[model samples]
Every structure is written in C-alpha cells, then in structure tokens.
Target: MRDPDLTQIDPSRHLLIAGPTASGKSALALAVARAQGGLVVNADALQVWSCWRVLTARPTTADEAMAPHALYGHVAPGRSYSVGDWLREVQELTGRRLIVVGGTGLYLTALTRGLARIPPTPPDLRAAADARLRQEGGLEGMVRDLDDATRARIDLQNPARVQRAWEVLQATGRGIADWQAETPPPLMAPDDCQRVLITTDRDWLADRIAMRFRAMLDWGALDEVRAMLPVWDPQAQWAKAIGAPELVEHLQGRLTLPEATERAIISSRQYAKSQRIWFRGRMKDWHLWRAGNAGVHPLPES
Candidate 1:
C-alpha cells in the first residue's frame, strides 16, 4: 500500500521491510516502529559506517528521535564488516520487537535465509584479491576465477561478493555455493515474520533518487567527503557508499560539483536497479506493495 496501515501490523511479530534505495522503505519501517513500538534496526550495509550518513541515506537525527534505531553509522571508516559480523551483532538486538529495514538485499536475505558459515579468507588471499581489484580496476580476475557454481550463484557485479566467493573457493577448496548448500537454520525464518517488499515504477524511483542525492548535497554530503579526503581509500569498504567516490573526485578537483552530482545520481539509480532485481529474485514470497490503490499482498497479521 502507498501508506501502509500500521495499525494492522501485529505487535508480536517482527517486520522485515525490503526494497530499493529511496523507495520509501525506511518511512514505512518508521511508521511500523512508531505504531507497534518496535526498534528500527538497520540492515543496509552502507549505513553502518560512521564515515557516511548523508551520502548513504542513513536515518536523520529527527528520524531516530521518532523511534529507536540501532546499527546505523556504528562502524569505523576502514573496518571490514560482513554479513556474518552483522548477524552476530543482530543477536544482541532480538530481545525486543524489531522493525529491521534496509535496501541491502544480501543482509535482509541472510536474516531470513541462513547464511553460509564460510571460513574467513586468509589475510594474504584477501590482500591479493584487493590488490588485483586495484590493479585491474574491476572484478574481472576474481569473477573469472570463481568456480562455475559460485559464478552462477553470487552477484557478478558486486566486487565484494565476487571477491568473497573467489576467496572461499581458493582458501577452502570449495565453492561458496557448496558451502551455502550446507547452511544451518536461519536466525529469523520468513514464516516467523511479517515481510514486506516495496515496489515503485522505475521512472518514479529514478526521479526520487536524483532529487534525494541533490538533497543529500544540500545536507552537507560534500562536507562529509571533505572530512575524509585526508585518509580516503577508494578500496575501503566504507568508501563504497554510492556517492562517496564521485564526491571524492569532486574534492580532488577531478570533477566539478555538477559532474560529481550527476555521476552520483547515475550510480544510485544503477544500484537501485540492482536492488530491485535482487528482491524480486530472492524475496519472491514477501508481500509486494506497489503503492496506490494496488495495495499489498496480505499476510498473516500475527
């Protein structure tokens, strides 16, 4: 539904809100948290780093003032946070009602669908992968080296996913897909929660993304980038925030502000497109809400 009936949400069940960036998912989650007295936990990977708030579309202070929020901007600038790490942290938050929300499909998926307990990649292997990424400026080598099954299963366009698969295959002599095939039960099974997937028309979402990025610029995103210029590392996990690279280029005088804004908007739109695809493929059973009078696919209230 365009405006979900938060009153209809069952207080006993957790809410899982998933959608592309700028698709009003956070707004819906906030409404649920307020109406149902649930904690709003972030599932978005990018919003975890302290280095980016405005650029990553993190909840504003006013938003947090409205409801309790956890896991937003809690990570240091150069840390390597993973879905496994996020899952560990999420365990501490489960004593209360929760409205876990974000556009990061991987995190949301792992929350409901068990994540593979793949071993950590050796530091040398990870370093080698990172080095190759910098030298090649793309995931070509890592993707090519992935086992056929992993190559089929992981997101090819996601550098982190590709590198992780490559590392798992190299370090363990088994494909990630093989490891995933042995995953244990999920921490939060889909049947135990109220799952909602927000969908919008493509052009409408693109317009929202562009306007949102421009608004982010107004909200001191450039200044945020300026703060990081002294220690900016393009390969850093936190540096992968969609607009961070473009803004970095802007600060370096490699691009004008307008050019950087355009690039950031383009990147956001592309990322949103990928997110939509991910949810469609992975969250097929989630109640799909197309807004307007189309409404939502009803699920169990409790």
Candidate 2:
C-alpha cells in the first residue's frame, strides 16, 4: 500500500502538537493557526487556570490576539477540570481547523479516545479515601482494587487518584476500572484528523529551555507567584504548577534568584523528558517531523 499523503492534512479540521515544557509546541500551533485560519485550543493542564499566566506559561494577550485562541487561562484556580470536559468543548467548537496543543498526555489520550463517564466523587467520599490512602499504602491498594486500564492511566502518586477510585466504587458499586472499561467513541475519527509530534534534538532543546527559564524570571515569574500566594492552596492544581515549588523556595529565602532559575530549568528539562516519552510511546503512530526540518521552524515550548 502507498503511504498516506501528508500534504492532504486539513488545516481546518484537526492537528495536534505536543511535547515538554519549552519545546516550542505552542509556537508551531500558532503558526499553523495563522496560516490556516484555525483556532488554537489549549490542551495543557495548568494553562486552564485563570490565575496562572506567567507561572503556567500561558500565552500573552498579544500572542492570543495574533490568532484565535480558546480554552487557555479560563478556568478558576481552585476548581477541578477534567479531560472529558475539554473533550466536550472541543466537540462543540465551530472552527474549521482545530489545533490542539499541550503537554498533558492524559488530555491528549482522552481527546483521541473518549473518557469514561465516571462522575465526580463527593467531598465525604473523597475524605474517606484520603483516610484510606493515608492508613494503607496508596497505589498498591488502588492497584489491587482497580482494573488494569484505570490503574495505568491514574496518576498513582496523586492522592486525588485514590479518592476518585474509591468514590467511583461507592457511587456506582463498581471498581473504577470497570467503569472505565467501556471504550468511548473517539472525539475525532481517524480519517478526519491529523496528528503531528515536533521532535527536537535533546541538547538544542535543553539550551533553549535554559534560556526560556531566565526569560520567565526576568518577566517577573516570582512576583506573579507572590501575588498568587495570598490565595495559594498548595494542594490546588494551579498551586502545584511546575514553577511553583521553585518560586515558593525563592519566597522563603531558601534559594536565591540564580538558584531558583537553575532549579526551574532542571525541572523543565525533566518535564520535557516525560513529554518526549509520552509522544514516543503513545503517539508513535502519528506523523512526526523535527522542528527546523524542511517545513518546520525551531518551535518554542509553550
């Protein structure tokens, strides 16, 4: 069989650009949107929070004005947002071309394959699960009870995972695994969508990442975090953003500006590694082209 023609990819329909922090995923998405007149919908986890612009690396107002951007920096800080919810919004979007960009692998997975309809667990149920997680080993217990699929996708290290699983069991009288076993229809059919992974050389990416972190600090990332601290809840999703710990350390005088910048750069490098792994393992079948290749630019990480 002949290979599918790459040029036939519809700009107005579907495209995905995903990689680690400072990988230039957003820049490529914006370029495509500008060229094709499509909408740039955020697929990132942290960028959804309204209070986190600089810390979450959300696009600036000027950048957004350059093209139509959606779902970025719109959610309230303390509330929980889910992949399923985003899937719904994406489905309802009227854009001729939809460019999805983000580093959250789970969100991408949920977009490609519809999420399980397990409802939110109540507060009391969550508290109980938290107690159980604290008393017993967390993931080990969840592993024992949950089906393989749920266990695999669930962030085992997160207490939120345990609470959600326990709540599913209570409300639905089924293991969280069982509920998620019902395979959902994909958001976009395979024939209707095109996916792309922007592969970058590791060394080049690392240097770019270091420079971006310095730029972020110069842009007052610490001050942004300080302004948010009056309302900070470390357990909140926004508060747990990648730059949070480093900024908090700076605020506490545990680290100098130079030290915090170094730490943030290191953390971003590791995060990029995780993004690369996800793209390689889960999105391997998708079309891939290295940034700076014939038709590509040295895209900056979002």
Candidate 3:
C-alpha cells in the first residue's frame, strides 16, 4: 500500500522537505524533484553562501546536473542573508511545482506561516547595541533589561537573536515580539503545500552526522575554510556556520585537527537536537517520515 503520508501530498502542489542536518533531506528532495519534474529551491541558510560548499554539505555537482536547483551558494560570504532576504528572493522565482528543502526552521516558517515586517535597525542603534554587547560581554542582561517578554521568549544562548531583539527595541522603541505581531501573509498557505518532516532515531542520526563530517573533511572542507580565512569576519552570518568557527580555531593553531573535528561534530549534534526541538514545537503537524525509508522508495503515483 502507498504510504499514508505520501498519499496525502498532492504532487501538483509545492513540496517542503525539512529535517535536522545530515538526515538525508537533500536526497529525498532530489528524488521528489526528479520524479515530479519540479524545481528544487534551497531553504537552508548556510547553503546559500558561495563559499564552504563541502562544509555546508550543499548539493553536489552531479546532483545539480540531474535537476534544476535554485538558491544554492548564491550569496557572497561577506554578506549577511536573513530569512526576510531569502523570502524576498523566493518570491521572485516562478515555478509550477517547487520542492523546497532545508533544515532552517525560520525559513520554512516564513514560507508557510509568514514573517514579521520589522524595519531595518538604524545604524546608530545597531552600533549602540554592539557596544553594549561588547561592554556587557553577553546579550542576556541587555535583552532582559530592554524587553523582558522578548528575553523570555527568545533563546538567550543565541546572542544573535538576543542582540536582534535588543536592537529592535532600541531602534523602533518596540520589542521584537511586538513587531512580530504585525506579520505579513505567508507566501504559501499551509493547506496549499505538501509538507514533510524527516526524522530518525537519535543514535542513527548521530552516526550519520559523524560520518558526514568525516566525509566533509576528506572532501577538502579545511581547504575551503583556509581560502576564506583572509576575508572571514566573525560578525558575518556565514562565518557563524557550524564548521567555520571550529575550523578557524584550528587554522589559528588554537585547536588541532582532531580537536576541531570533534568540536564540530559535537556542535552539529547539538544543533540537530535544537532543530528537532523546534520541529516538534512548531511543525508538529507536518507529515513525518523516517529517514532512509522515504528517500529510497518511490511513492506510488497518484
């Protein structure tokens, strides 16, 4: 019998495949695109940067050759690309059927549930926030002092999010939560698209994460990082990619190869765990598919 989840998805509509990193989401997206003759649009945040292809595990050359891919490695490393920017770019693409795939929850949420139209923070406010962040040495206190509600809602551990909220509060005299209350309509309504969430046993996923990092190292991830070392800026979004910081530490002699590899793997696992938590909290209704099974077998034609 056809899989119940697949049976519910209409091939004619847009398809969204989301999961934690190294969960085989890309392969499944490729297979769906090949079978349905649809465009594969990237939703991963890091995969948009032109640098660090291997480190990001972006689509391989052979995979791109098989199907039309959009938004992969399209941005310069020095630039910061946000979910808003990605949404704007995606809006410009025209396709009858698009297979959107990635592990970025914010991108997926923006596509389906809409995003806040928060204006760009003023430079002075941004500088002030940066100064305070540097002075305070962390955003937890600053965010709490500025907006208690936002501080409670946002991940305090993520300095970027905390600083962003603080900046918004400073620039517009309103909390980020308040701005989010006035969100625009989603590009694609929930009922209009076929959404799938790939999940697997934690042990199985951990193994895949470790294997993928090893393969990335073998495939010249270090070389890619080395090339970008001269221009890498810690504040840039691409620089914050999981492997980038760890590898930079290695290149600077602060960490040995093995140490960097272990650190990157541990970070990847932690990130995957966080993604799983986000999926459970925000995308619980999306159809669930166990890794390996859905990608290897073709769904019965509707």
Which residue pairs show collisions in model 1?
none
lDDT of candidates 1 onward, in order: 0.83, 0.75, 0.83
Residue 236's lDDT within candidate 2 is: 64
Candidate 3 residues 211-248, lDDT tens each?
88888888899999999999977777788687889999
Candidate of highest TM-score:
3
List TM-scores for all candidates, in order.
0.91, 0.86, 0.92
What RMSD does each model have against the real structure? 4.5, 4.5, 3.9
Q: Give the TM-score of candidate 3.
A: 0.92
Candidate that beats the other on lDDT, 1 or 2, i.e. the better one: 1
Listed per model in order, the count of residue pairs whose N, CA or C atoms clash below 3 Å is 0, 7, 0
How much is the lDDT of residue 71 in candidate 1? 96
Name model 1 segments beyond 4 Å from true.
Answer: 1-4, 136-140, 291-302
User: Residue 239 error for model 1, in Å?
Assistant: 0.4
